[model samples]
Every structure is written in structure tokens, then in C-alpha cells.
Target: MKKICIALDYNPNSEKIAAIGHAYARALRAETILVHVISEAAFYAMEYEPFMGYDSPFHLNNLDMVKELEQGAENFLLAASLHLGTDGIKTQVLEGETSDAILSFCRENRVDLLVIGTHSHSVLENVLMGNTAVKIVRHTGIPLLVVPTKMEG
Candidate 1:
């Protein structure tokens, strides 16, 4: 594989995924790219409607908020890189729907393999809220290395 992409989120279990993904990348002698996609809901968590002369409590404007979000995501990828203790790994911070962003990036970058973390979800929960890993699996043709990040009961 020439390039391997690892998708990371804010979930704590992402650390495990990163570790295993990096090890695999090293073994394959492939270039690694760590990607973090910031969903719009994550950036705009508050719902507010302004009435006559009403102002939103959020101090930063939308543009500033987006900048902050991007910076935070960059820091996250950097921390993951540091934790992996590796050099020459590329990092990308994308904006949009999580799974779509990841898949598009992989396709555009011609990533040979995608590494992702999967959370344990009950059948009902899976139906109610579709999982990103599931969505990727259904849509992408790239090879995947899904790390199970289920917490112990």
C-alpha cells in the first residue's frame, strides 16, 4: 500500500485505533495520513433565535468559531501523531459530514487502506443512529482495518 488513512474522532477510544493503525502502517512501510472531520453540528452546538435587539451569548462569530474548530482538530491530529511517536505522517482536518468527508478524502488521495474505530452498538441503536464505520463499509471499495473500541461492561 502506498498510502494509508486513519480516521480519528474525539472519542477516547481513538487512541487505541491510532496506535494499532500506526503499527500497521509501519509494518507495511506506507505513508500515513491522519484525518479528522469536523461536522457542522459540532461547530454550532447552540440553537438561538434573535428577537428584537437580542444578541447571542456566543462571543465568537461564526467564522471565528470555525477557525477555532479547525485549530482544535489540527491539535488533535498532532497529538495523535505525537502519541504514535512517528514522523513524516500527514494530517488533514476536513469539514462536512464525517463519513462522506473521510471517503471523499480517501478517494481523492488514492488511499490504499482506511483504518477506523468502531463502537459497539446494539441492533436497535444501530438502526436508530447509523454508524460511520458501517456507512463507510457500505459505500467504499477501499480495504478497511476496523478496530473494535468497545468499552468493557
Candidate 2:
């Protein structure tokens, strides 16, 4: 395998996922890419819009917020790469639906292996929000390695 890609989120558990992914990449002598996606809703929320006859107060016209987020993602990925002592680690910050962005990136980049973490969500939340991991698993042909959070002993 030449390329391994890991999808990262804002969750702190993502660090653990990155660590495991890095170890596997090293074992396979493959390069790693850390990918992050900014959801469309988040970007749109920065602007003011009336909803239910009331305007949202959290409005800001600056698009620099998105840029900041991208920068943050880069830094986060850099930190993870350093933790692994792995060289040539690439990072990408995309804008779109999370699962779609990840799947599209893996396919377009011809990634040999994909690594992701399954969040621990309540049944109600999972049912309402749907699972990004599950969506990716169903739609992608790329080999996936899903790293789950370590269970308490």
C-alpha cells in the first residue's frame, strides 16, 4: 500500500484514531493524509438569516472564519504527524458534507486504505443525525479501517 488516508473531526478522540492510523501507515511503509471537512451548514451559519420570523443574532459577514478553521485543521494534522514521527504527512481541509467529502477524497486520491473513527453517540442522536461512518462504509469501495474508542476495562 502506498497511501493511507485518515478522516479527522473536532472530537478529541480523533487524536487516538490518528495515532493508530500512523502506526499502521508506518508498518505498511505508506504515506498518510489527514483530511477534515467543514460542513456547509456551519459556513452558512456565519451569515445572518431570518428563521421562523426571527433573525439569528450570531451573524458575521467575515469569511475568514472558514480560513481560520482550515488553518486549525492543518495545525491539528501537523501535530498528529509529529506525534507519529512520520514524514511527508499531507493534510486537506474541504467544505461539504462530512462523509461525502471523505469518500470523494479517498476515491479521487486513489487511497489504498482509509482510516476513520466511529463516534460514541446515543441511540436517539444516532438515529436523528445518521452515522457518517456507516454512510462511508456503504458508499465507498476503498478498504476501510474503523478504529473504535478503547472500552473501559
TM-score of each: 0.88, 0.86
| TM-score between model 1 and native | 0.88
Ten contiguous residues with the weakest lDDT in model 2 = 56-65
Write model 1 residue lDDT over 39-117, tens digit each, in one string: 9735464546775887765543756676788899999999999889888999999888889999999999999999999
Model 1: number of backbone collisions: 0
Clashes of each: 0, 0
Instruction: Give the per-residue Cα lDDT of candidate 2 at 80.
Output: 72
Each model's Cα RMSD: 3.0, 2.4
Which digits, one per residue and each the tens of the lDDT, describe model 2 over residues 22-55? 8889899999998888786365446656788886
Best by lDDT: 1
